[model samples]
Target: MESSLATSQMSDEIVCFCGQSSVTRTSLTANNPGQRFRSCSFYGQPDAWDYFSWVDPPPHPRYKAIINKLLRKDNSKRNDEQQLRRLVKCYQIALEVFLLGVIIQKIWL
Candidate 1:
């Protein structure tokens, strides 16, 4: 779980087709959570699209379900947070409008 370890865990054996050295990445996908892979240094670029090699064996089935469930729960929490942010913004605008109306009424009186 150390991000520092992830980048430093290099495979001298793997060099991409583009001649860049491979870097290790942990998969976050539902099907293969926590599994490591070797990817091109030029990943996300046009030429490296096809470069991927597994560095670790496939995860056990039980662990896969647990990780996927955790990921889903985290995603749901983030969605709820975003919805709350929008609601708070709407309330702030409504309060500002109410204050503005009060000021206008006072001036007319």
Candidate 2:
């Protein structure tokens, strides 16, 4: 229950003033991470409709802080996982090189 975003319902039946269908999308900005919103599907196109609405109510200050903290923790874990994978790969290559050297020494002796 870190966030209520998962339980929030997004409106897919929204329509823009210009008669265009609205698309539901989640926000990834620092200030509004994980928040969902609906906007015109044709937004930003030339001569297209522009509209926006939040699916979830504005988060309280406490909720915002909690969400941001969780996001930082998740990102750190991801970075650590990637670094570990790289380290393992380097070790594998070194082991292969060492085994090749040992084989060459045996053949020469």
Candidate 3:
């Protein structure tokens, strides 16, 4: 019974944080593409991340600065605020999903 419970937790079980149904599975490739051992499902797929800003490559020197400046609460610019809020919200959602994956991994594995 204990082992079965563990196995069930290891399987792709989706539980939403907000009392809704979680629809996505946790996969290393979906979470981290830069890792050479993983395959990105959206690799080379057009319109994959339609809303995210295109950072030509990861580890760009200006990327963090851009994100910070855009996220500044004091910034009165409408476009900057909108972009920052959207990105931040998306980040928060992804974080919740990732953390959920970790917890489930621990409980049932």
Candidate 4:
């Protein structure tokens, strides 16, 4: 399944009652996974007016399965990236500590 960003771009023709362009978004809930809708860009904000429209109908069961699979893959990649960032931070700290120890030893000699 393609990302909502692309769909939002294509929804430029859709405008809210407030005169703002509508944006496409995907439902991430367990029941409506990957469902696409167009809503006001400010939809959910304090100043938002009630506005919503569907960009695509609910996917067929087989397509839903495919979208769910892609969602899982994307989530896994995000998790892996986060873990790598944490690991790199730890390595950077360790390197800094090691360099500090080396500097202390040189000063004592």
Candidate 5:
């Protein structure tokens, strides 16, 4: 409930990139779109959301700790992506080496 209120306070009504203030229900039907919800129809696009940079805006001190934790979590995600890529490359290399070894053994034996 608190998060919902935050989102509501953060979001505002504005014309969409298409110059339409409201989109039809058919536009958002697949991604939680329905007659009850209003959307800009460009909700799926990253650029569809308005950007608001906090320029020296003050926040609760507790949020500072939360921000640090979130940054750590973001760094961990990068490490995880890197590890996953390495695993995939290692698997491919191992498979290729195994095939080459099999070919050599068959030819010699």
Candidate 6:
């Protein structure tokens, strides 16, 4: 199974004072799901300073639900559009083949 944590190369701008880029993860709790943040590489070490930063604020539950719903709808629409395009291409090919057969019959006669 894939972990939910996202890995990124730490840049100079976001490096911890300890000179190491911290790993980033999203909160998966019921109250703070999808909240992104970064932590120091030496997090939890007795010698390391506490380092944490939020990359994005947690949205209201209602807002999150609405966003998820809209995303699902958008994905469904895209899949429908792709299926329609494939159907249209198949129809076009079939029409061309039929027309060619008709012309060949006329030529033989």
TM-score list, all predictions:
0.72, 0.63, 0.30, 0.73, 0.43, 0.51
Ranking, TM-score, top scorer first = 4, 1, 2, 6, 5, 3
Model 4 lDDT at residue 83: 100
Which is better, 1 or 6, measured by TM-score?
1
**lDDT score of model 5?**
0.53
Q: Candidate 3, residues 1-109: lDDT per residue as tens digits?
A: 0111111255554322222222322222322322222112232346332112222344334655554554453455877879999999999999999999999999998
User: What digit string (tens of lDDT, one per residue) describes model 4 on residues 14-53?
Assistant: 6666766777898875556788888778777886866777
Tens digits of per-residue lDDT for model 2 on 1-109?
Answer: 1111111145536556565567788876668977898766765577665566689977777878888888899999999999999999999999999999999999999
How does candidate 3 score on lDDT? 0.43
Candidate 5 clashing pairs?
none
lDDT for residue 71 in candidate 2, whole number 0-100: 87
- Please report, as a residue range, the 10-residue window in candidate 5 with the lowest summed lDDT: 1-10
**Which has the better lDDT: candidate 2, or candidate 5?**
2
Q: Pick the candidate with the highest TM-score.
A: 4
Best-performing candidate as measured by lDDT: 1
Error of 6 at 3 (Å): 14
RMSD of each: 6.9, 8.9, 23.5, 7.2, 12.4, 9.3
**Global lDDT of model 6:** 0.72
Residue 92 displacement (Å), model 1: 1.1
Look at candidate 6 and give me any clashing residue pairs: none
Error of 6 at 100 (Å): 1.3
lDDT to native, each model: 0.78, 0.74, 0.43, 0.76, 0.53, 0.72
Off by more than 4 A, model 2: 1-23, 39-52
Per-residue lDDT tens digits for candidate 1, residues 1-109, read 1111122336436665555667789999988998999777766666454567788999999999999999999999999999999999999999999999999999999
- For candidate 3, the per-residue lDDT at 12 reads 51
